[model samples]
Target chain A: MAKVYNFSSGPAVLPHSVLAEAQSELLDWHGSGMSVMEMSHRGKEFMEIIHDAEHDLRRLMAIPENYRVLFLQGGASQQFSMVPLNLLGEKKSVDVVNTGHWSKLAIKEAKHYAKVNVVASSEDRNFSYVPAEDTWQCDPNAAYLHYTSNETIGGLQFPFVPTPPEGVPLVCDMSSEFLSHEIDVNRFGLIYAGAQKNIGPSGLTVVIVREDLLDRALRITPTMLNYRVHADADSMYNTPATFPIYIAGLVLKWIEEQGGIKGIAARNEEKAGLLYHTIDSSGGFYSSHIETPFRSKMNVTFRLRDESLNDSFVSEAKKNGLVQLKGHRVVGGMRASIYNAMPIEGVKSLVHFMQDFARQHG
Target chain B: MAKVYNFSSGPAVLPHSVLAEAQSELLDWHGSGMSVMEMSHRGKEFMEIIHDAEHDLRRLMAIPENYRVLFLQGGASQQFSMVPLNLLGEKKSVDVVNTGHWSKLAIKEAKHYAKVNVVASSEDRNFSYVPAEDTWQCDPNAAYLHYTSNETIGGLQFPFVPTPPEGVPLVCDMSSEFLSHEIDVNRFGLIYAGAQKNIGPSGLTVVIVREDLLDRALRITPTMLNYRVHADADSMYNTPATFPIYIAGLVLKWIEEQGGIKGIAARNEEKAGLLYHTIDSSGGFYSSHIETPFRSKMNVTFRLRDESLNDSFVSEAKKNGLVQLKGHRVVGGMRASIYNAMPIEGVKSLVHFMQDFARQHG
Candidate 1:
């Protein structure tokens, strides 16, 4: 079967070469006589796999020594609860910038444990743009300042990382845009991403947290939710998502081959650029609801000027082997998630199809 | 590369056919043009896969209509906290039989949330036997009776499921023994098994909860840890372990081919019988510490009488394409886990090799 472009938000696309390599080694991982899935997490073979995975990840991100990279199980949503449960230590409140869908979700879950100070919200404008950091009303005494670096649903993203008040740790849900570009690891007190997005597969969440923040967990925090427990055990407190982590290792290797973060970011930029350029040039036939500066390079959400053609547009795209091009239901428009693995050719094909669709109906 | 029989407790061996199928479709799943890992959890393809997985699992167990099956993350350890947090509703205590290592782990986590009643224990003799049910001191007012169905490290197993006090729910951590045989699902209010054992890969945990028990979660239960939340959303509260669930689906399909629960149980019994028979008939060469009728059919633990040959025994086994044969550190001998996926041929080879080793070392 010919491969087609998968534009799923996540569990989303992974690299083709990574998949090919995984396929070739699925039965016997480097002659260990066991699939990576079957190998014990504590075994020497798997220990090297995980160590190299962490080493490559640390090399990719230049993660500081004071920070611990934890390979975890639950997706980003679990971290929403874990963040407040673990980070709220003696403080009763935390600051959050409500950008869009994902941010609101984080805020909602955090509210269960901590007093959530919603510093700023873009919801008044249907979450189309990022609110300037100057407008944020952060509480200086807050435990931390948390924000979503990218909101996939509204296609809102910050052009710059927001600054937290003095002594306040900055936390970011880098789920959708993680590793799409190089960012200063020092800017974050903790950074977490669900592996499904730009990483490997779903189930394995990567959390990079500063050492000092590990012990701040509330006593009521579930043992599994305690960052320090996982940090201490090197994230092998219990059996991790072993197979997913192995695939993530392969992906990290692929990222290295593509010239690490910068090279892949360049590729991501080109793919997103082509799709966005097609949307911008289509004279009212295509429009992105997001503000120009805030548009996401990962999830390019756009709409057909003639809304009634949404079904035909999606069906035609499927016929052309461009699948999962439909938008999230909450925000009704097409979402083309061109993550790191989406080759430039897929984007070109999408741009070509967009032009043809616009011409046939324009 | 030749396939070795992996005897690691877990993440353990998966069916050869399942791995083959996954390899064949790693890049393009049935021409949907998306790998199982790449497809969106909410998409039609994944929905069908998860649905079929749950359906087959339910059929194999003969689960009643009132049960809600959830495909979850965080492994069995997460369920340790979750069981007490969710099931200890209006009650203040729960009954648990201390069978072995896994049971103690669960008790330690549960003690944080409830008053734990030690119903029975086999720890006095290094967990070599299950305590008789008649000796239990169950609390009638307790919320539930929890037990480990099989203890892999100490090779202990309950010959029969323990009875809960009248009106108290029976909860079992069937992680090591789930789906290995037929059981009366009606007796259990909740049964959870980490998928790596007798199932699929690690990280994905299967939970079967009687419907009425879903609403009993304590107020502080993390939304992700709440049984009702997963049940209401059909375990799609967030992006689940999609690829692991897919592999588990294939494993369930393989189980169906093996004549479901009963047939697989017969194979497991025969495998264990051959191994135990070898140890018993070896004069004073290979000795099993576990008491008869209380030994696990899943993990067959034994030691060479000399004990000095432990290293050589493991190394020799590896040379013969039998790997991961060393026992867990807590139990210093050997553990040959003859899970459902371990074909009869593998067990025969293991028995034959064990006899040869005993004769040489004797």
Candidate 2:
């Protein structure tokens, strides 16, 4: 069976070369006579893998020396609580922008640790656009301003980074779009993403935080949940997701070979352009509610003109070897999550299928 | 090169068959054209993987209907805090037994959430023995009795299950010895094991708890850290460690093929017996501090008569294709963690090397 384009929002696609490399080394990594999964996280081989992964990521992101990159677990959902538990030290409140599903969940979890102020929201428009920065009610006294850089479910992405009040920091959940584009690392106080999307597999979450923000965890924070503890220990406070980290290293290397984030971003723009063009020229057969400027370059969401054709559209798409194209259940349409790992060819295949499906139903 | 016996404590060895299976399915799983790593957690393929993993684990452990088996992340270290955070309820204090490294860590973390009673400790003897239950200063009103079933670093295991005071539950950290031997499911209120040993891989932690214990989580507990949230969501409260869970399913299937826990236990006993006998009959050339009955059947810790040879001993062991035999740095000596996946032949090879080394250095 030929490989198909997998457009799952997360735990999403990975570079085929990385998977091939991992397969070749699955049993005896570097002639160590043990699978990467079997090596101790403290062992030299595994340590090297983790170090290279961090180093490559730091290079790719052009991360500053002031930032600490941590490989964590429990996905982005765990961070929804951990971010507040660690950063909301003396501050009683945090300013949050509810862009979509992920941001909403983050707001809910943060409320358990601190008073949450909804600074801005796109819910008024079904989360199809990013709220303007001037409309945001920035809390000068809040611990930080939190927002989702890209909402996988809604396929809406912030066009610009929001600046927090003078004393407050900015924290962004870049889960779906991390590494798909280059960004100024110094612009944010913290950025985190689950590895499944562009990094590698599930089980590992990458956290990039300014080093100065390490010491402010609440008194009740668990040692594992404390960012300071992880940073102090080099993310080895305990047994980490060792194999996932190894695979992520392979992915980081692949990205470098593809000419770093800049090259990858160019490809992502081209892929998104092709898919969005198909949606725009569908002659009323398909529609995308997201405003042109806010449509995600990573996840392109659209719907058939007739909702009744949704099931057959999905089934027939699968038959043609394009799978996981169904949008999030909440949005009720179709979404093609063309992350960094997604090839332009895959997007072209998807666009072709979308056109065919629309013509038959039209 | 032939596969070597991997003796790393956690992130230890897994069966070759499982690795082969994983490799074969690395790119296109079951003709689905998407790697298991790429599938969405909500997708049917990934759902089936998680469900089968939980189901097989339940069957292998003979876990009762009242128990909720959760596939969590952050290894066992996360549970060190979560256990107390969720189970302490209105009880201000909990009882803890200091067996070794893991238990001591658990005790330290539990203190952040609850007042801890050091009911009993083997720390006086350098954690070489399990303190007798009769000697325990039982806190009758404590929330739970927390203990380490097996200490990976010190190679000490409790010979008998410590009975908590009536109405108090027992919480055991079985990170190193889970599925190594069979025990009554009713013997403890909860059992949590990090999946690096005797299971699949790192990043996924399995928690088996009584259903009734789920609701008592502190209001301050992070939603992801709360057991009730995980139980209700079937451990899918967020995008879980999907690939790790799938690998765990494969491991569970392998254990079943090895005749379930009972058969695995008999093999474990035999393997551990052979290695321990080599140390015991070393004619004072090597020694184990653990009391014979309390010695762990998973991790076997010992030392050479002459400490000067420790480094060379480890190097020579690696040359003989017996690697990761060096003990944890905290405990300076040697530790062979022969988990469920370590074949009898691996133990035999280690025993052979031990005798040869003693013959030259004795």
Give the best candidate by DockQ: 1
lDDT of 2 at A124: 91
**Residue A155, candidate 2: C-alpha displacement in angstroms:** 0.6
Please, what are the lDDT tens digits per residue for candidate 2 over residues A228-256?
A: 99999999989899989999999999999
Q: Pick the candidate with the highest lDDT.
A: 1
Identify the runs in model 1 with alpha carbons over 4 angstroms from their true place. Answer: none
lDDT assessment of candidate 2: 0.91
Error of 1 at A16 (Å): 1.0
What local lDDT score does residue B175 receive in model 1, on the 0 to 100 scale?
A: 91
Per-model TM-score versus the true fold:
0.99, 0.99
When only chain A is evaluated, what TM-score does every model earn? 0.99, 0.99
For each candidate, give the interface RMSD after superposing the true interface residues on Cα.
Answer: 0.9, 1.0
